[model samples]
Target: MTKGRPGENPAERPRAAVMEDVAELAGVSAMTVSRVLNAPEKVRPETRARVLAAVRELDYRPNSAARVLVTGRSGVLGVVCFDTTLYGPASTLFGIEQAARDSDYLVSIASLPALNRRWITRGIDRLRSQSVDGVIVVAPHESAAEGLRNLPPGLPVVDVGGGADLPVPVAAVDQFAGAARATRHLLSLGHRTVWHLSGPPNWIDASGRVAGWRSVLEAEGREIPEPLVGDWTAHSGYEIGKRLAREPGVTAIFVANDHMAMGVLRALRETGRRVPEDVSVVGFDDVPEAAYFWPPLTTVRQNFGEVGRQAFQLLLDRIAGMEGEARRMVEPELVVRESTGVSP
Candidate 1:
């Protein structure tokens, strides 16, 4: 027996000894010992028990880094996101993390700043250097599409909402369709015409929504009024709402997102306009708080969790050399609430 070090318990030894000695005593290979540690269910119960007993006897602890080096698989996936604080991107990240954990994989996130070309390029380069098995990019801005043009070939990527035209596999909620549905619902309520509050024009989703709202109204032969723009914020929505409140003959409105709709609600209330009474409102992105709005909100629901799950799976498939269409679109659902009603 090895003597203990000075002021240390002489009986204890480093954990690495346990792993090596266990493999030797159990008459198994080191790779077998690793499999037993990393994937217990894959090893036969009898062999696994023997490894466990030897491990206990030798006090062995396997090193994860060594295992990763030998296997060439870190079991990690990298996610690049823009606007980490945004409701949709944040929720998608949570979903991706949870799904990765469930699949016995690790997720690492890198938040891109403002979805600019330089930020996206640098983020992707950083993730590549980390040896991530694949990458999922939450590219909600138009600049992301431009960035995609510069990505190195054959790097597995799944884009979320970069644009309608994608060079790699993509998973996105159908913003255009959702916006059209919201507009149609308001029109069906007997509103002569509907006004729009749009998000920042540079975002792909915002552009799709704006186009959808415009196309629907134009198809119905309704007069299309100039849409007010917001920065996907409640404050911007409120500002636009204030302007709408002062305008005459504005009976119905569709705001780009629920957060902004909250601002619209505040403005309408301050201006003495009752929702669904003097004015009706509908919004996109049925965020959790939408239901709790004063009169509740009528909005479009984008299933961001589903988007993340599908995007990750698509990336994995791509990494495995699977071939399929590069773009995929998810449909959104229109949620009806108390905020919209028949026009007077």
Candidate 2:
């Protein structure tokens, strides 16, 4: 009887591949494979290419559990945010997760029940217990930003959408610049002065926008109408818009966000005010539906994706013990649509 070579039976399951198998297949030492996987920049380009080819050929995946045991790093990141229900925060979370995935790291989120010192501390503790390599905080409210300033030292941390001059690194859209641009656009169109509809008073974004809008009006020596504060919602915008519609001198208005702008549009229409013809409107945050708004909303386009990417990169740098630029502010663009026009 011919003996089939020891364990070559077709019915036998192929063994799971390991780093040793990959190293052998690539004609390299196990240490070389390790360097290639962990720090590819330190490995010769030709050597890395060969090891990668072997890994693909065997469909090898790194043993993350074993890696943690050996290196004391879980290869995970922590994210702390107040609410993901809102568009800005939700989008920022998505961006961070996407960035983490691209870098072969896992994300563990701790959504806070409230934006305060106690909750922030609890969130960081939860993540620390999981052995996260670093953390990214996505809290835009002043209370949360203030809490971040005194976080217990040791863990690498970065802040997203937080205020300027933070103790940790920060990544955010230049809210001031965006609002200023919107105000300038209205002024350029021959509007005597642009009124403002701002977001909640507690948010850093709202304050930045207010400062920007006021700065422009002051520099241009234009009449600065007192800004109407809203809760960053359509209803608030509608309520405020109704009041503005009744004012005869209100020719141009800059709103903090798109949802409020939609409400303002409705309020104007119901009050017999034709948009642009009677009241030109401009809003921030070019939400997906902004362009579809009746007459299309002229708004500021914030690159949340870029903000997320920068936040992730900052965390990575912090983890590596690098002291790079502490704050990276992304520039926002102005999108012109049919909702705005020359003062009429």
Candidate 3:
């Protein structure tokens, strides 16, 4: 036996708690605790609650090493995505971690600085080396989604914000509908013609928003102006906004995200153009800061939390050998704020 540390009293001290201790405290068998931890759906709600309560009270955590040795499985999920500093991707990552925790699993994450076929493969490989049961990729850009198509066979995978008609399962926001709604709302406010500032062409979300905006303009018989393109940044928006501010006929503009909207607002202010008075501005991804923007921002709200949870569920289902139509789309909502008003 390993020698105990100095001053340690192994004989008098209670041993670290085990699953059996938790089961006894909850008045259930050890197998029940196992089921609750592994296949919670199989256990009745009441029993699962009781076991979980006991687990919490006892501060019980399964012995991952022993469990892995016996089961040849790691009770962990991997989340692979780009930077988490951006609001949307960050929120999705948070949601995925929360969902994994609630389901009694740990999460390993690989955040790439830039996404490419080689980097994505390396990230997946890193997680695979750790034996994560499955992975969820937040592949908004085309390149990231393309890398996913070449993943090794038998790896359970899901994607959040994947490209259109992706072969793998995906959970994404209905960007098209949300964009249409935002544009339609502006048209309802009597904007004769609405201009758009689109996100980068490489992102599916960006393309979907552009398509939706285009469809609305076409339907209303309005002439479409060339949309300004942004790399989904405030700086890009500022540059585009400066040009639009110089145009007297540009009365209404829809930006692809709130970050860009802020830039546009600033650019308009600098150019002596008034929001709602001279030009009505709308943005997408009703981020937390949207409501706090100067004059606030009317925008589309994609429930990234829900999308992440759905991706987690889909991945889990695949890991359990169930598959088909795992692609799920969460609808986006248009939130009205002070930034948009009767088009001048």
Best by lDDT: 2
Q: Model 1, which residues run further than 4 Å from truth?
A: 1-13, 16-19, 34-45, 55-62
Task: Report the Cα lDDT for candidate 1.
Answer: 0.86
Q: Write down the RMSD of all candidates, one decimal each.
A: 3.2, 5.0, 4.9
Which of the two candidates, 2 or 3, achieves a greater TM-score against the reference?
3
How do the residues 2-72 of candidate 2 rate in per-residue lDDT, one tens digit apiece? Answer: 43432676565666778898999999998898899989999999999999999999898888878888887
**lDDT of candidates 1 onward, in order:** 0.86, 0.91, 0.89
Residue 149 miss distance in model 1 (angstroms):
1.9
In the predicted model 1, the residue pairs found to clash are: 4-10, 18-60, 19-60
Number of clashes found in candidate 1: 3
| lDDT of residue 225 for candidate 2 | 90
Candidate 1 residue lDDT tens string, 36-58: 98799999999999998998876
